[model samples]
Target: MDLEKPARPPAAAPAGEGCLVVAVRVPVRIVVLVLVVPVRMAWDALVVAGRSLNDTLLRPLGRALPWVGRAVFVWPFAGLWRYVLVPSGKGLAWLGKVLVVLPAVALHRHVLTPLGRGAVWVYARVLTPVGHVLAAIGAGVRTGALWLGRCLVVVPSAWLYRWVLAPVGRAAVRCAKGLARLVETVVAGIGTGLYRGARILLVLPALAVWHRVLAPVGRVLAVVAREVGDALGHAWRVAGYVSIAVGRRLGTLLRRVFVEPARWVHRSVLTPVGHVVRDAVLRPLGDAARAVGRATRQALAAARASVRRARADLRRTLLGGQTGAERKPQLTHRREPNGPRTRTLDGSTTALTKD
Candidate 1:
């Protein structure tokens, strides 16, 4: 809404009144300058000077001091191996020496020492007496067992050996002698005849059969096996030759059917098709895609420029500048002659302008 003022003639204030107002404001500003302005200016000047000094001189000096010392002073003496590495090595050695002993000492004082003492005390106070008593008891048990074994087992076994086992053993010996004599008599009467009968009845027949029957059969079977093996060897050789011929034919068939035909089709058919595709399809499609990408990029750039301009205008407005009075550039379009036409997303052909 326009708050339109009615047009009227300007009313002039008296010159004296304007002069009086100026006069009053001038003294007040002078008083403020005397009181507040000097202090604030002093503080701001000091802060700026200090910060500038720190940034330019102090910071550079601080950085240069370390670099200069390391390069000039420290590095010059760093090559003295004894002065540099020896002290550090000694310090580390001392540290390791001290630290290693702490654990060992702690173990001996807190654990091993107590454990050894406890073991000695236990052995002296408890196990020593117990071992003596155990030894006495063991000795008594051994002596008693020895006495019992001699009285019960040894004496009784001796009596059994004298009274029962001795007589039985003597009778067994006599019986064994009589049995031997009888065996000798039987051997003399029948052993020779039996041996001759076995030779005639079983051994000689088996030997004759082995020599006449089994041996001849084994030789015949061996001859038949040898002939069969020879025939199988001949058949295997024939099959191997036939297989070699068949494999050669198969190799030719496979080459003609698969490898050669595949190569021919790739050369005669696929190559031409690939050229046609590259020319008719891929080239035009790539051109179209590049054109579309350029158009999209141009549109996006324009939108971004517009957004940036809007943001700048908004910032100016926020910073107390007049917002509505900023002159915005207008886009204009002109038609081109014999130029490639660009289509909008909506399929409209619009004129384009450079500016």
Candidate 2:
């Protein structure tokens, strides 16, 4: 018996070993794979489906549970009154009054008191100054507007008289003079024609009347009548010429005095007034408008900031991890193989071994 140290019994085949010798029929691995893969897949799918179902069903329940619990607890007190204390009409009415009173008292304490205090504080601290500033600005603007309107009215009137009415008036006067001259020329021409016609008609009538009647009379009487008629005619002609000359002179003088002075006043007073109005009234109005614009912008900016702060508060209340209802920590489970196991230094799983 070669008692060499009993050859270490061939290391026991690995735990998951197959039979050897005589061509040990290795069970077809395909069968195991087909069974195990499907079963693993089905189990994983079932686990995932179950988790999804739990999440879907429980999420809304979690959100509503607290409110439902409160309602359930409160229902008892409500039921006690309805069933025991308020079974009769009078008792029900009394219960109703109690309910109303309690709510009223609660509202007074929680809402009305705080709201009133805040309103008073705002009125005292914020509204008064704003009102005063707005009133002062309004008053200034109104006064400026009134002054500007007056200047606008007066200045335009003056300018119209000076620049537009004066020249127009002067032109009208010249046109009137030209028309008068034309009329005078036409009248003179007409008068001359009438005189020639009258001379021809009168000469025939005079010859007939004079030959028939005055020829029988003395020559001295006819000659005297003729001289008187000639003197009257000459005086009338001189008077007509003097009247036209006087009328022309008066019209020229009137136009110069009234129309020219109006033009001068418009230029001297109205133009300067318009300029002054633009500088004094319009400039201040522009400044006030700019200031109001700035104030409005500032108010808008403050309002935007306040709104942002409110939104931030809402976000923190609704979406913050610690306080929010929707944001909950997830729980996970991991399974590890049992028995003595080995792992790589990098924390990867390794095959188990038996010593």
Against the hidden reference, what TM-scores do the models get?
A: 0.42, 0.24
Candidate 1, residues 1-355, lDDT tens digits: the string is 7799878987666566786787798799999889998899999999999999999999999999999999987777886656878888999888987899788888899999999999999999999999999999999999999999999999999999999999999999999999999999999879889999999999999999999999999999999999999999999999999999999999999999999999999999999999999999999999999999999999999999898889878888688665544757665664343357565444444534222
Candidate 2 lDDT by residue in tens digits, 1-355: 7867755665556676666631343455656787799899999999999889879987778988988987888788788878876677777688877998888999999999999999999999999999999999999999999999889898899989999999999999999999999999999999999999998899879998989888777677778889989999998999999999999999889879998888888999998998999999999999999999999999999999898778777888787744344458776643443446664444444444322
Where does model 1 exceed 4 Å of error?
1-172, 187-191, 307-355
TM-score of 2: 0.24
RMSD of 1: 41.4
Candidate 1's displacement at residue 353, Å, is 57
Local accuracy by lDDT, each model: 0.90, 0.84
> Which regions of candidate 2 deviate over 4 angstroms?
1-244, 319-355
TM-score of 1: 0.42
lDDT of 1 at 91: 92
lDDT of 1: 0.90
lDDT of 2 at 353: 34
